[model samples]
Target: MMEAVKRFVGPKWRQYLAASLASYGSLCTGMSMGWTSPIFPQLRGPNSPLAEEPTLQQESWIGSLLVLGGLAGPIITVPLSRYIGRRWLVMGSNLPLLLGWLLAGVASDLPTLYVARLMWGCATGMQFATVPLYIGEIAEDHNRGALSSLFLLFINVGFLLAYAIGPFTSYWGLTACGGILSLFYVPFTWFIPETPFFLVYKDRNTEASDVLKKLRGTSKEAVQAELEGLQALVAREFKEEPKISDLWATRGNVKALGICVFLAMLLQLSGIDVLLFYMEELLVKVGTKISASDGTIIMGAVQVVTSCITPLVVDRLGRKLLMWTTSLGLTIFLGLIGVYALLDSYYNYDMGSWAFLPLLCLIIYMILFTLGVGPVPWILVAEMFPVKTKCLASGIASFMCWLAGFIWTRFFRDVAASYGIYTAFWVLAVCCGVGFVFSATLLPETKGKTFDEIQDMLNNRSKEPKPVAV
Candidate 1:
């Protein structure tokens, strides 16, 4: 495994560095724009008179509009990657992001903030689609999983940083810090390269070879071998142009699509967003009278640490097995939290020992999710679809992901308000159970497979065992 990684990373260190930097750009946007959610209850809590602040409510509305704007990209991202290439899209999309950040930082009203967030979401979604597509295309088969997993790790880092800043800036102010952080995009565009696959897609074979050679710094023979592998993978995937109809017309792809949607939905409804959006309230209910501010920071810390464990082990455990184990474990933990909440409520919130249990259970649930569904699904999205199906499938799949995010964010507040925190957790536990069974039965292992070979595995064309690298 070390030899295989060296063969790719030896010559391709520059390309790897560029890709990693661009990935940071995407994640910084994700982390910064949404930092308020995790700590919203603290900054504008029900207990605080500032709860009436239009700013916090508007931020939620803006988040919805932002997701709506992102939904538009599926129409163009496929053809855009095919025509203009992924690198230029990455370069060009930053313009809107920059503008959005400027507008948001300066905004004083709901309307202005809404428009800013909408535009930011569109550009940010483009980055999300393009970054992984670009990274997966550039990485040599032997090292792609580890490299792609880095994107997930850095995203959590961004989340950790953003959450840290949210509370930090509350002491300082939002506008100043947000504006300063937004400028990171300028250097991102300056540094990253166009994906070699995009060049190949346009029939710029020589440029593609040059990019590949730069990224795969080994002997001439090894470089040639790497390019040949990529070319073969691309050739196999692109034999047919993917159509929207293919989603339903092909049974195997449809099954894979269904599984992706299920996983995406499960990720959201499993109360991950609730944990993010309402950590303070949940923590208070369960027994800790800790400030919402401190609770948000603790939640962020858990997320960052737990997410670190996934990248280290995901390539080794294989995707399906990881999902199976964690989904089941998460369900049990969530159920425990629900029981604790119910029991505590009956005791008039006086059972301090029982109250802390929900907080402890939630931490365990977050760790389990980070180890499996959090990063693995994104990696699967990058690897599962063929070139033909990749655009629409990814678009639809991503839409499902954000849609689920939207639902959880919008409804969890109301649910916690009406049903009580205990019942809310029970609902999440049910979803986790569904996710575990679906994963164990329907999701296949895609570890150690080439991008094209994964498409083949999805289609069931090659059944002979593909070797799993430890």
Candidate 2:
């Protein structure tokens, strides 16, 4: 299987390695989020300065503030990359994340804690915007989908590690151990190269060609052809500086941007964030006595195990098949979880048999959700846009994703409180149904096409005929 994946991936393997490191960074961020959440309760115990209260207001504040910071961070990465290059910008963004983690480790007040989370949020948003961009830029038409799926795999790994550690926070003395672990990323930024597209755009063709040769390890003739193809594409698509408003001005871009934004909103409407952050609480709501923090570790373990399969299957199954199938599966699993919660709330019969059911359903949901929408949108948003508007378009799309995330976190507590868990699951089920319709009609297959081919496909412009292999 490893050899087969390598064979199918062709010459652009090194680029994928770099993209995977960025994916590692993304995974670390998610792990950090959940890892920190369960420990907040510990921090509030009698020994610590804070007091533990599972209040909706406080949870909402933490979730929404991080999202708000995510909303604001990625908008600037486009121009900054254009000016300095992808490598430096990615490196520079880590400062805030590291600093925030350090601050949170020592934080004694609610305001200080919020500030640390805000910075971490900003780091996460920047990763969402830029990692896909970096991967998409360096990938060949045949392997882009596979390369992009790496994001999903590593992040799930992070989620799994985060959950696994939540149960051990007391053993480690404080959650500060996790935050300090996050700070180790500060040195990795120096090791990766600037993306090939950034090199070419700055008129450093020789350098770009050199990087291409090293990354591809193909014959000089093949390397030259690939470099020329990239140069021509970049020169043709991005000859002019992209304006932010361009995402809305033209019909093609508007359709493109609309699809991306709606998809982002749709991805969140699945309630993945709420499920992830509060998985323990939701499990308890269905009648488990295990501590929410310990439950979080179990949730993460399930996510990691399930997510391990996505990268293996994503490229082979094709995007649409994987997406709709997983969406449907998630809807069913969520429905089961909600039903279990409702039953536990209204009835007091034997709860042990049903006890494991909620946990089982949550695990199934994580698996299905990872299989489909979790990683594909980030890859699609990065690939679908023309180089001219790639940054601005992806930025707006990511911003919409974070915005929807904020909405979900803000209302999740109240919805669970008032209507019960069933209502929230029912609402998300309907949203997933709508996403099925939109994806069937609007989301194009981006698996085998080059960026130009995709743009032409989207624009109803024909690709010039290729010579027969003979």
Candidate 3:
């Protein structure tokens, strides 16, 4: 039966399945992140389920608390990633996500809602901390970029599900959708093999080789060649045994750390996550010709479609190209929206002739964003560090990302309330512009490169940049 299934799935089926299942973690996060956009209206409307409409401060907390909860997630998973291995860590993350949604479903007050979001954040943090580690381990040198980009693809799908369903369903029904999806993900993960890299690191050579055979689905000679190469690479990278403190101990590791952290910060500051969280509210403020809910649905659909196309092109176009192109595009569109917001605010300039500009600008921005900034940073982070420091290094980057999201989402309302949304969009445009420079000046192209080669590139092992493999 297993052989028949393997034949149907092709040679790389295990790698694709593992990545697909791991991405379900990101799917839960998208659902939770986009949850606020549609439901905030119901919660704040005249027919509210809570005893009262939440105060502005309370609303901010409700929106950002999941990110706040994400802050604590790495503290738990970074340590556990080594002890339990990547497969189990990913499988275990689903428990908290399921519980978080269930809690949100039963909540009658602000505090319960806060705790539920916090739990979801923690689950999200854990997934980000480990899935990239798992992905980096399983992917072939030839297809790493395409496989890693799968993370954001499913995330957009989850976002579309929430945005499409939220307007039509009751609050409890949406919460149930989140809970069921998370619960549904658990059993599928049980079939995937533990990463061969993790097994090699633990000196389980026989099991590692067996897993390699399953993953490659090739002749024993081919599997053994890859396995032997990995064993040698691990031995070299893990010299003297690494600790968490080593995340900043060596200059090379520190360089990798700085690059990944900066990229992660740029991703959040590009205004993608916060904008998704507040899509409906922003559309209302911009006063689009179409209804806010309809606009949100359209944007979500675009994200889902573009994200699928990105994975097909990322390996071919290369990382730096996509990052630079997307950053430039996001900057221009964000600046355009800021202009409309400025006119709409300071001048009370009625956009009678140009009402479509805001939505059009937004739709274009989402397209460029989904192509690169949305997923590439995660791929870049996964490629930067060796397994020895991956958990600690990736965890720090993940922490910075969530911190940025919390700061941006938590304060966006206050800024929009006082200065208008223009202020925030203009600020984020500057950030995206900086992202363009960062990609052009500092980021390396890792397309089709092996992990050993990437580490060598970071360590300055070669005077010239390695050419992207055909």
Candidate 4:
């Protein structure tokens, strides 16, 4: 049995398995993000367990506080991962997530629930900033794009699980299921090796070589050659500790940071967090015949299916094409939604007969979103920066993303209350249009390129500053 297992599990199996384990962290994060969708309405419903039903103001805080915690994740994760290594940090993140779910499962008051969510948010922040770094270091060039995309795939899976199951379970039951995810993730993630790049950084060349061999399923000579190349690349790029100022110091650095920050802003502005937090409410408001919970599940299913497409085609179709295609699609769908909402509100046009329209549009919007804006930004963040500056840049970009999410999630109810939800959809549509323009004119195609090659392209493009037409 041992011989058969050894023969069957090839060298690349280790890389695939490690990436999968890292993705489970994303699963937990997604569960945390999606939990409120089901629980919020329940807490406000008469069957609620709270001493008093939550007001809209309190509910908004519950929805937005996770982003607040996420905003703090990068501050700690960047330095922690740098010192202790990515694998341990990844393993350690599960503890807080588990605790968060446990607290949510048995909480007698809203304050306890808030603390639970904040803990989950912090774990999410750590996962987002660190998982990509780990995957980027371990994956071979040929499989890197697909492997990195798995992070998003698992996230959508978690979202789907939460939405699909939340309506069927009691509050504590749902929380228990979520906690089970973290519990399983903890032990499984323990076995994956630390990234070869980090090992080399610590001057453990021999161990790096062994890890490379295991990851690549290659012979000793091939592993040695790969290790030498990595050593040369690291030596050339990482002479000093990376600084925040390095993001602004050089032309390439400035351009990379600008694109990443813009992408992060565009991601949140596109309304993902809004949709996740309020999908059930939005569906109900649209007067869909479908139950709010059912609509949310359907949306989650669409997201998972579409997100799965990205890993298969990201390397083949290249990042630029996917970005533009999905951005344009999002723009059209969001615009239609805004138009529908406006017509229903002002013109008193009865939309009940066509209630399915908003649902259809939302489902399509989620599909396009998961395909492009959802996963591509993280992939680009992992790809665009130099190794030395990658962690800092990723942390800064992630902070921007969570901050935007915090603002949007916190204020969306106010905006909808004041200007109408149509206005919110219109605003998101405009953001999508802007993102399309950025992708067409500014973003470089990084398909099949080595890290050095990508850096060279950015440097050369920075020198001339010409836009690449779609």
By TM-score, the candidates rank as 4, 3, 2, 1
Residue-level lDDT tens digits of model 4 in 171-276: 8777888998788987888888899999988888999999888888778798887899889977887788777788878787888888888888889989999999
Tens digits of per-residue lDDT, candidate 2, 93-175, equal: 67667767776767667787789778878888887777767777777766666677776666766766666666565613445
Better of 2 and 3 by lDDT: 3
TM-score of each: 0.85, 0.87, 0.91, 0.92
lDDT at residue 323 of model 2 (Cα atoms) = 73
Model 4 lDDT vs. the true structure?
A: 0.84
- lDDT, candidate 1, 1-470, per-residue tens: 64674576675676567667667666656564455454454435443323255553454564466666665555557667777877777676666676776776665555776777677767767776777777777776666766676666666666666566666555225445545665776676676667777676666767777776667665556567656666786787777766689777765677678777778777877777556645555777655555656666666688767655666688789999999899999889888877777777755656664545666677778788888877777767666765667677777777787677777666655665687777777888888898889889888888887866766767778667889999
The lDDT-based order of candidates, best leading, equals: 4, 3, 2, 1
Clashing pairs in 3: none
Name the regions of candidate 3 deviating beyond 4 angstroms.
1-9, 219-221, 444-470
Residues 215-285 of candidate 3 have per-residue lDDT tens digits of 78776777998889989978988776668788877666888888888878888888887789889989988
lDDT of each: 0.69, 0.72, 0.84, 0.84
Task: Estimate the lDDT of model 2.
Answer: 0.72
- Judge candidate 3 against the unseen true structure and give its global Cα lDDT, from 0 to 1: 0.84
RMSD of each: 5.2, 4.2, 3.8, 4.0
**Off by more than 4 A, model 4:** 1-11, 448-470
